[model samples]
Target: MAPTAHSAVIAALRAVGVAPDAYGPTLNTAQSPRDVDVVGEGLAGEIRAVAAPAALVVWDTSDEAVLAHVVARNLDIGVLRAFEVEGLLRVSPDVPAGAPVALLATQWGERRLAGLRTLVANRGGQTVAVAAALTSPALAAVTDVPTAALASSDEVTGVPS
Candidate 1:
């Protein structure tokens, strides 16, 4: 049987020496209804600032809800569309140089990462991949740089929502 998402996330975190439970119960409370909206807004703002004329590729339906919320805000930055990985790969849209491309996912998996890499290679743009959990593996896979390097690099910054 396949491991559940929760288990997979926990295992991924543990593989990188992150004790999932090290934070204890204080970090395990229920999320508020507005949490997704808040996160989405921040992410949307970041994407808009850097890559206004960008495409948003979402990996899961849950993420699409965030996309919808982002769209409803009518930020007027540019055309923001959500595509499945396969569809985006097939479409292979043209991305202008220096424009930002964003991938939104609640979890990271091999297939999704591979697709994002391919899309970036084919489209040619600054890449930003955001995962709801932001595990170490996810960060490394998205950046193709050592996590330590990312920690020191001014180019990459993470704000926890």
Candidate 2:
């Protein structure tokens, strides 16, 4: 089974105790280089915990290093682009189990969970990703990322990749 979106990598980062103030631009979108700095810091710690491969889904190309940091820390990473609910849904079903993923987006707060769940389930076991809201409010607001953006496995597997 694959990791779910609830326990996604970013959520796990929070679960492990990384300060929000040290992780991003705001809490919505990851636009500031400062936000990436925070994410990289927290991600460094996360990478040390897991022994398996992981992936990251980012909304911007600017986030490659953030993803690379995770990979360098020892986790695997994949990149996704978008903060919209539907965009995440389109990319979720492909996360591999034991391979947590990270989601980097702008501040959306608690307005998006349905999409997170759908994406998280793609991993099968539990969600695994480090999510960074590249904007403000500095907290997930909710326990998990949004799931509203996810689509069925059949719909996502064939995506461009």
Candidate 3:
């Protein structure tokens, strides 16, 4: 069966860790992107456990690497660059039997779960459950002990300022 859009996105992310050759691009560290995605904040330090010093951490929140990958994939590569996407859904391969770890996403996040689930399964994790929000009574009832949830908020303290 064909992979879903979410799965495809996940595949793209897991595919990003580079086998960098010599003569790589440099980071200023002072610059900022006008927008960003896939904020894997702890990935660099986490990667140190598995990689040598020169290994390229592709998920680093740097525009140059991010843009390069985006262009290479011919994917939409801009900030606040919104669009509606339809995704295929399928049972993840090699999901651990009733594993507690799983994906929960909506909008963009939901789209990436397809690839992400495979990565999770590879890491001995299981994306056993997923949902966009707690608004559904069925979801709320079933997810009494959900391990993680994701959302944005206008509820931030200074947001209305």
Candidate 4:
């Protein structure tokens, strides 16, 4: 089964060897309710910011939950320089992809042209391939890399150009 947000958050905390109870009060944001607004969004932001190649530890099993907890909590204790599995895998030039190639597409048919370049750069400066729900002239400007038409943003998952 897919992990719930609570499970994911708990796992993130434990990854860093933190006691689950140590997390301060969960905040409620002006946005959605289920969006369990952690008081220090900065904590999550820091973890994600340093995670190059966009180390995305998507918890498919219980194992990842453990890993997530460690990452989440340990990162908050101090500015740790240790590498997580995702962090290592993301930056390792030896990986088959050399650099990860991301597919940027929008489900809502918004203009992807402006955002694609920045998203790719932000995500470990990886090569970007643009996919769009509908074709647009702006996408044509992205010539140095590959571009394609995707049925929806969801299709971009794990799809390399």
Ranking by TM-score: 1, 2, 4, 3
Off by over 4 Å in 2: 1-42, 46-53, 60-76, 80-88, 105-108, 122-125, 133-161
Per-prediction TM-score = 0.44, 0.39, 0.25, 0.28
Of the two candidates 1 and 4, the one with more favorable lDDT, higher being better, is 1
Top TM-score prediction, candidate number? 1
lDDT of 1 by residue, 87-157 (tens): 44532345566665555443345665566556655666655534333334544555542121112111112
Worst 10 residues of 1 by lDDT: 146-155
Candidate 3 runs further than 4 Å off = 1-38, 42-89, 106-143, 147-151, 155-161
Least well predicted 10-residue stretch by lDDT in candidate 3 = 75-84
TM-score of 3: 0.25
Supply the TM-score for candidate 1.
0.44
Q: Give the per-residue lDDT digits (tens) of candidate 4, residues 47-161.
A: 3333322222221223223333333343442110112264221222222233444332211123333443343354444543443222345655667756543222122222343
**lDDT by residue for model 2 over 45-67, one digit each (tens)?**
44344323355554333334344
- lDDT against the true structure, per candidate, is 0.40, 0.39, 0.29, 0.31
List the pairs of residues colliding in candidate 1.
none
Q: How many collisions between residues are there in candidate 3?
A: 8
